[model samples]
Target chain A: MPSLFFTRLRQGQRTLPFPDAGPDLPERFRGLPIIDQSLCPSGCDACVEACPTDAIASDDSLAIDLGRCLFCSECSNACPQGAIQFSRQYQLAASRRADLVLKTGQSLQLAHRLADDLHRILGRSLKLRQVSAGGCNGCEADINVLNTVVFDLGRFGIQFVASPRHADGLLVTGPVTRNMSLALEKTYAAVPHPKIVIAVGACAIAGGPFREHPEVLNGAGAILAVDLFIPGCPPHPITILDGLLRLIGKIASPAAAHGEAP
Target chain B: MTISLPSFHNGEPISLASVPLLSIREFREEIIAAAGAGATLTALFGTPAESGRVRLFSVLGDPVAGGLAALSAEVDDAYPCLTVECPQAHWFEREIAEQWRIEPQGHPWLKPIRFQAPYRPPGRTWARLPGVTDFFAVRGPEVHEVAVGPVHAGIIEPGHFRFQCHGERVFHLEISLGYQHRGIEPALVGGPGKRTIHMIETLSGDTSIGHATAYCEAMEGLGGVAVPARAQALRAVALELERLANHTGDLAALAGDVGYLPTAAYCGRIRGDFLNLTAAICGSRFGRGMVRPGGVLFDVDPRLAADLTRRLDNALKDLEDAGRLMWDAPSVQARFQDTGAITAETCAALGLVGPAARACGVERDIRQDFPSGFFRFAQIPISRWSTGDVFARAWVRWLEIQRSGVFVREQLASLPHGAIQTPVGAPRPDHLVVVLTEGWRGAIAHVAITDPNGRFARYKVIDPSFRNWIGLAIAMREQQISDFPLCNKSFNLSYCGHDL
Candidate 1:
């Protein structure tokens, strides 16, 4: 017991002081993409052809939808003119799906806080029921890390409950498959009234890589009205925390936090 | 008469015509005889042949000889099952029957393995829901049944477990999966296009490097591309890092299951530290987009390599401390030592791979048996424990963690200098290739058969989970029902990996 105590003492406080300050993200970490239309050569669609998922739309102006983007940077690598670039900005959550789309030279906007009523109802604490519906366990594993000592998502009073009855909202992962659609719906219904659904990862938001497969229902949006969308192949734990904190009105919008715009 | 099966080396492409086509009777006889003579059946699947017939392929691995044999037989919808003689062929036979809609005549306990439609031309479907199959039931006054999951309490993939128990003691446990199946194999049939590598990386998301390496090796084999020694060393480093992270996480999860908090807390952080090292190398923590066909996408520069080595050393030190704390704890040892014990005989019979087999003293590691890529140059000693219990599994993981740490450090310090990426040509037409990668869990095998156009005609992936899930179920026999989580974590099999 004494040795165990000493070990714990050596480990020290492991949680990140996030929302107060951002994580020290790696330089190579792919996040919000920047598109430069000026750099794109005439009659070039290399990035469009290279994108596994059709996250890039190059008909007129270059635009990327974070909802479908896997952050693989294949498009960036494929572009000869260097038209597309992925920045290390990790805060890519959005309240509305349309907000996830970034046009040429546009930066990713932070997710909007919940309505005043929601803040009154769930501002202090949020209980989430995570349902992994056909997820490849990547998203599930990252979400699990939220509770670990490093991320310590519980410090924010956001807890993942075992039962849907106890949850205030449903945190759905995976590319909701046919076999899990029924269970996902049942889980959503089990959550009480005024329940919010937050879709985590590329799979939960837009089916990510398995997008057009016949077996998957695409994502959580096909079944439920998602209140917030967090994007990544599997969003990093910090990304998830940022999204959750923003949704619960725990953090200000990136624009407001920077004291620039509404 | 002794049957001669066409042999091929791992990561080498062979013409499909070279694999001898046997009659159904001969195929069954040969496979059964091979099993009797101590060969492990690696993979068995069927592809559509001419005139509504199916070409069934069987892969057998001989650990002693360090060789792999492949043979095929054409069957017209019905064939004699080999499971009657070879118990290891049970699940593989069921999978063939389910996917091809072929009837393995007179096979016992035949059922759908993935509960999906056939990929063949006719597409005769099985009209039943997933997890709604006939379960082996035990009935008596004291005997009761317990069904768990498809939706588990914790964060996990979906699978159904039905245990027949008598007063808290489990008699038999049947695991029914397929809830996580997304038809990934069918998605990979056409070509090695843009999405193929991404699909392979997520074949089992936790095993990103393992499956990705296997898929790349298969592609490179067909393309006849030799990966540079530097790229091979980089891949080995990433693969070992993946193993280290997962094994550390599993050890922590096992401690968590038994309520040993110190090891659980520290190891979780240590596991994340290892993942961060991978991320430092290739952006993503899971090593996504790091491994590409012909070579890896990212290169570990000298500075990053040094950083990785330093972090790895620190993490290894911390992991050793936590592991010592847990192993020395009497409570943890008491919970893990005898619970969920599977004998070496049972492990070999089930053809279990990875740590589960090694824990049973089976000595079956793909890295050793069929050396490919970096393994051919540098071999890490196989770590094995004889107990075949939860403790043995955890102990094996600790030993592996130490070895993998040493390997990663050594490779990082001496990283060969060269270009990381090489251009790969089109796959050879009408060829069959099998690539085996020892994933963190076990052996991940990918078999790709190309058409006349050099497109993938049939791609088969056999995750180690497919072979080890049964081992978990069998291990639960005569154990306490509540120890299920501990046993399940000790094995730590992948659901989607198995389902696909």
Candidate 2:
């Protein structure tokens, strides 16, 4: 018991004061991608052609759908002109699906505080029920990580409850597979009214890598009315936390959200 | 004359012509004979052949020799079931039936593993939607059934569990999954396209490094690309880091399940620390983009290497302190020791791999048995425990955690110097490659057969969860129903990995 106490003491205060001061993201960590179309030669479509998920518009002046991007850096690697680069911008949550598609000079419209009534109800203490439809468990893993000591998601009063009945909204992951479509719908139905839905990760936002696969329904937005979208192969835990906090008005500066990297 | 199956080393490509195509009877005998001689059934899948016939390929892995024997037989409608004699072929056969719309005539339990439309529907649809089917039931007046869900009570993937129980004791446990299936296998039958690596990386998200490495190995083999030594070392380092993170998380979850908060809380944070180390090397915590076809995408410079080594040492120390608390606590031991015990014989019969089998005293590890990539040059000793219980599983993981920690440190300290990646070309035509990676959970096997046009004719992925899910079910037999969660965590099988 004494050793346990000592271990706890040694581990000491791990929870980051995130939002107050952003956590230090690794230099190599690929977050919000920056595309400078001006550098692209008129005939050269290297990034567009090299894009795996068709994330980059083929008939384009360089616009990338972050929802469809796996952030594998193949596009960047294939771009001979160094027109595209992934900046270490971890805050990439958007209020609408349209905001996830970033053009050369456009910034993402970060998720806004929930509708006045919903914010008033869930602003302080929002309980979410997570449904992993056809997810690979990547998003789920990071979501679970938020509850760990470092993130301490509970500190923000955002707890993941067991039952949908007890939840105020749904936090969804994965490209909604036909097999899981019914279960996701049922879980959403079980949640009380005034419920908001958040699509987390690339799959949940726009099917990620499995887009247009016959087995998937593209994403949660295909079936449910999604209020928020966090885009990543599996969005980093900090990205997820930032999304939740902003949606609930716990952290409310949309100006400081996208395109900024430390 | 004795019929010999074409054998190849791990990650080595074999021409489709070189593989012997035996008669159905011969193929069946070869499979059963190999199983009898202690060969693990690595993969058994079907591909659409000429004349509307379905060609079935069976891969038998000989762990002792570190070689794989492969043979094929064409089945038009239905053939003799291999599961009757070889229990390990049970899931693979059902998968074939569901995917190719061919039946395993006499499989004791035949059902769609993933409830999706067949890839090649032989004039009809045999597949049903998820959870709309029958489960093996135990009939008795005192027997009451408990069904737990596709949508569970945790922040986990979806799968259903039906426990045929009397009071708290269970008669039998049946697990039906498919909720996470996204037709990844069927969707992969093409050249190494843009979306291929991304799909493989997410095949089993937690085992991203494992599955991705397997796919990359297969591609490297088919494309005849020589990976640089430095990239190999970094990949192995990343792999061990993945193993460290997952095994630590499992131990923490096991502790959390037993209501031991101190260790759980500490290890949980330490798990993130390990994940952060992986993220340090590659952008993603799950090691998604770190591993490419020819080699790794990210390089650990000298300064970064030293920094990672220091961070790893600190995290390992924290894990050791946290783990000690759980092992020393009597309450935690009482809950973990004998609960959900499965015998070594059961483990072998069910073809369990990784720590689950190691916990049962089965000395099988892909790194040690069928070494590939960095594993060929560097080796981690196989960790084992004979108890075959929750405690043994946890202990095996802890032992592995320490060994993997040491391995990662060594690799990081003395990384080989070279280019990070080599240009990989299209896969060679009419070749087949099987790659086995020892994921944190278990062996992740990927088999790719290419077409004449240098595209994928068929792609098969067998996650460790597919082999060990039944092991979890069998472990729950006769145990207290309350211990299901603990037992479930002990195995920690992937639903999507299986469903896919």
Candidate 3:
């Protein structure tokens, strides 16, 4: 009887740390897009299109928005440069939409400049909301992972408010598959005035790979007012963290990722 | 990949029998005839021709004909409809109907599961595709449609399940998917590269090894490449760990679903323990580090291997004690018994695999019948039973767990030392290599294309859920509404895995 009691005691003690540490969150646990920009091949846009979320962007160079990425890692795997990765930092969960917006890696200079430009244009504090255009769920999956225990993004003083009506910015993921226009339009229209749109993944920038689909209507920037552009297939979590940091001036410049030519 | 001439696949001319469907009207008839014959092929899913025509595929088990093979008929919208007689085919047919506009003519329950009504040219939105006839119009009394997802309240993947009937007893259910269709089929058609494994590994997070192992086997089979014996032993070890981890977690989940918190908590805690062990050897915990195209990517750490065996032996004893408590408790047994009962007939008709079908008395496991990788070695054992119910599922998974321990021991003792993987420079072009793995769930198949140099051309991954989701819809019939969590848990179909 004493031994059984001890066994039970041992079992209970083990579970003590419980969910405070968060979920098992598994390996390749697709959290958010974190780009090691140093590894990216500049002109290749496979990840941009691979993201069901338009969480990737590359008008000139690639950038990412933590707020919109799905963390599908389609880009990381598809990337010839091995520039993207899925980080284990899932607990960026937040209630507000904009609190999650983060730019990652050496690309922060562009993001900082873009954020300054947005602040100048708005002349006030800003908030952003994200909508997916024909992206695969990679970006969305990561974005959702952020809402879990580890990242608890709400602590970052940002929130992922569902509606765009009260937003200062808009984030987009995916290549704008033909089927998503109405939902995108509805989401876009729901946002209030003085909004700046940030295209997140590769798809929104140039329609990514699914560009010539007979059904798709590409170019998210064409649909709204543009601000900053972040690119990745599905960037990594740190990239997302970096992207948000860049927006709020927490980080001076976009950081370089691990294992790069630098 | 060798293309054998169309000999006789279940006594039918395989590829030559199909004709290009000209319109949607004719296609409806086909569904009607097949449905009447008790043919309930869930998804008419396959690759579309680059020339812009769709291949209409259906899985059938004809008593007169015999066996299950995906019967493909490439056609335009004018193919026949199978949904007319098969009322359960509303969602899949609708997806096919909207994506290709190949309507199932006589579908009794024509409803907009995904695509919105009043079809649009490019008006097809994400959740709302172009269009399918609205299903909400036919509402049963006392029960209203509760549209659950595409975006869920939990961290689970997106799948829209519509319940039909009054509040208490569910008369019927319709599951709508295709939300995360990342164009995996199209991506597979290009050169083979890392994407194949990436896509396969992520096919279902839990089913990773199953898919990857099967994929490596298929590619090797096609290329006729011999794997190093040491790598084979390591693959066996990895597979056992994966099975052990998945089964332990699943048993706990099943317990939790029935509201047994202790069992739930116990199993959940150990779930990651095995994954951590896997990481101790491989860089990634998902076992993604090894098992490449030709062979495994790396060797296991000998020290790590020794540690794993000890850890596993200890876990086995703890698990056994827990199982005793679970089986003896009346409340737990009450919660489990007949909660999710799938008949043997239903399983055979649907062709469900793994524990889901095994529990129902369907004695089919790819490891034994469709052998690959380390499975051919006489060292490992295959555990099975033919119950075909939730209890049966639990039984099979438990047996597998026990068997897993034995396999791990064998693997460690017989650990071979040698080079792990051969160099894969580039792929041979213009050939089709089909790879299949017996994932914890069941058969995981990967279709890879290599160009002349051995780099990827195109790769298609078909996880068991692609076939098993059909069993879920059928199994739910006559089950009480409250038991859905139990029923769904028994099958545990990976929504993200299938959506991709």
Candidate 4:
């Protein structure tokens, strides 16, 4: 017992003050990307060819879909003209699916607030049940981290419950394989009415790299009506927390949270 | 007598024609004899053959000789089962029967393993849904069956577990899993295209670096590409980091299961710190996009290497404290000490790999047995404990965490200087290449066979989970039902890796 107390004292405080202070991400941490269109020469398809998931499309301009991107930064490595660079902004979640697609020179915008009814109901507290359909456990690991001491997602009253009945929403991960499809649907149906479904990670949003596989049903979007889409191969814990906070109208905006001019 | 099966070293490719094909009787005898002579079956599967016959391939790893022997035979429909003689062949024979529609006649317990449709051209399909197979029953008035999950209570992959319990004691536990199958092996048949590496990366997402390195090593062997020393060193560093992170997380999880909160919370945070160190080098926390075919995609410069060394040291300190707390706590020790013990004899018979096998006092590790890449130079001592219980498993992980930390620090201090990557040409036609990587989970085996057109014809990935899941089931027998979570976490088998 003394040892436990001493260990706790030694660990100290590790949680980050997120809304008041921005996250201190690593130097090589690939977050939101910035694409410079003028740098690309005519018919330069190196980035497109380099992408493993076809996240980059080179039509009139280069557009990257975060839902499909693994944030591997292979596109940046393959870009000969210095066209694409990943910025250190960890705020990349969005309320709508289409908003996740970013064209060249477009800055990442904050996710919109939830509906008035949702805000009134779940603004103070939100309970979620995570279902990993065909998840590789990467996303599941990150979701589990949200409950750890550092993140302490419960501090904001966002807790992952054991049963669907206690959850106000469902946090779905993985690329929803055929065998898990029925189980995922049953869990979704078990949630009470007016429940929100938030898709976390690239696999949950756009099937990530397994999009074309015959076994998977693309992602959760194929089965359920998704209210929020958090993107990353497995989105950083900060990204997931930001997405959840935005969905419940806990935080005003990403720009406001970071103290930047909108 | 020695079997006339063609043999090759790790990461060395052999021509498909060079593998001698024996008759059904000879093939069965050779495998049984080889197992009797201390060789273990690494892989056994069937590929489509001409004239509607299925060609079976068997790989036996001779650890003492440090070589792998490959043999094949053409079977029309049914063949004699080797599991009757060599118990390790049980799961492999059942899998071959399911995928090829061939019967391993006279096998004791045969059932659909994954419940997925067979590969095309033969086009056999099972109409039954996943986890719909008949289970082994314990019949008595006191015996009752408790079925749990295709959907579990925890945030984890889906798999069904059926336990026949007598009062509070479990008589037998049957695991039926196919919920996470994504047809990954079949998807790799055509070519090593753009999606191939990505597919390998997500084969078992947590073991991304392990699978990706194995696949790359197999491809490099087939293409005759030499990876730079620097890239090999970097790959080893990433692999060890993966091992460290996972072991730390698992120890914490075990602590959590036993209601030891301080270590659980601290270890969880420390695990993230190690993952963040990986992200400092590459982009993803899982080490994705860092390992490519010819060499690694990212280079760790001196500055970044120093940063990693510092962060790793800090994380290791934290982990040490957390581990000490858990081990020192009598409550944690009591819960973990005697729970879910599997004998070394059972471990060997089931062909269990990784920490689970090591915890049983079986010194079987790919890095030591078949050293390839950087492991060929820098060696890590095999971490083992003989108790074969939850405590032994946790202790083995703690030992590995310290050893891997020392290894990563040493490698980072002497960061090699060279190009990070080289171009890999087309693979050799009609060649078979086997690559074994000691992933965080255990020995991850990737066997790639190329067609005449230099494309992947039959790509087999044997995740350590494939060899270790049965160990978990065996460990649960006659144990308390409430200890299932502790035992399951001790094995920590991957559902999708096995289902695939």
Q: By lDDT, who's the top model here? A: 2
Candidate 1 chain B, which ten residues in sequence have the lowest lDDT sum?
A: B119-128
Place model 3 in a CAPRI quality band.
Answer: incorrect
Error of 3 at A82 (Å): 14
Residues B336-382 of candidate 4 have per-residue lDDT tens digits of: 99999999999988888999999999999999999999999999999
Q: Candidate 2 — which pairs collide?
A: none
Write candidate 2's Cα lDDT for B299-344 as tens digits.
8899999999999999998888889989999999999999899899
lDDT of 4 by residue, A1-262 (tens): 7877887888889998887788878777888887888898879899999888888998998889888998888788889888998887788888888878887666666677779988788778888889988888888988898888888998898888888888888899989988888888999888897799999998899887788788889899998999999999888888888888887777776442222211
Candidates 3 and 4, the one with greater DockQ = 4
Q: What are the per-residue Cα lDDT tens digits for candidate 2 across A1-262? A: 7888898798789888887898989878998888876777788888878887889984656789988888889999998888889988888888988888887777777888888988889998999999999889899999999999899999899999999999999999999999899999999999998899999998998888889988899999999999989988899999999999889888775463444322
Name the TM-score of candidate 3.
Answer: 0.66
Instruction: State which candidate, 1 or 4, has the greater TM-score.
Output: 1
Proportion of true inter-chain contacts also present in candidate 3: 0.04
Pairs that collide, model 1: none
lDDT of 1 at B412: 91
Error of 2 at B443 (Å): 1.1
Residue pairs with clashing backbones, model 4? none
Which ranking of candidates, highest DockQ first?
A: 2, 1, 4, 3
Kindly indicate the candidate among 1 and 3 with the higher lDDT.
1
Q: Which is the better candidate, 3 or 4, if ranked by lDDT?
A: 4
Q: Write the residue-wise lDDT of candidate 1 on B125-176 in tens digits.
A: 5754778888999999999999987888888888999999999999999999
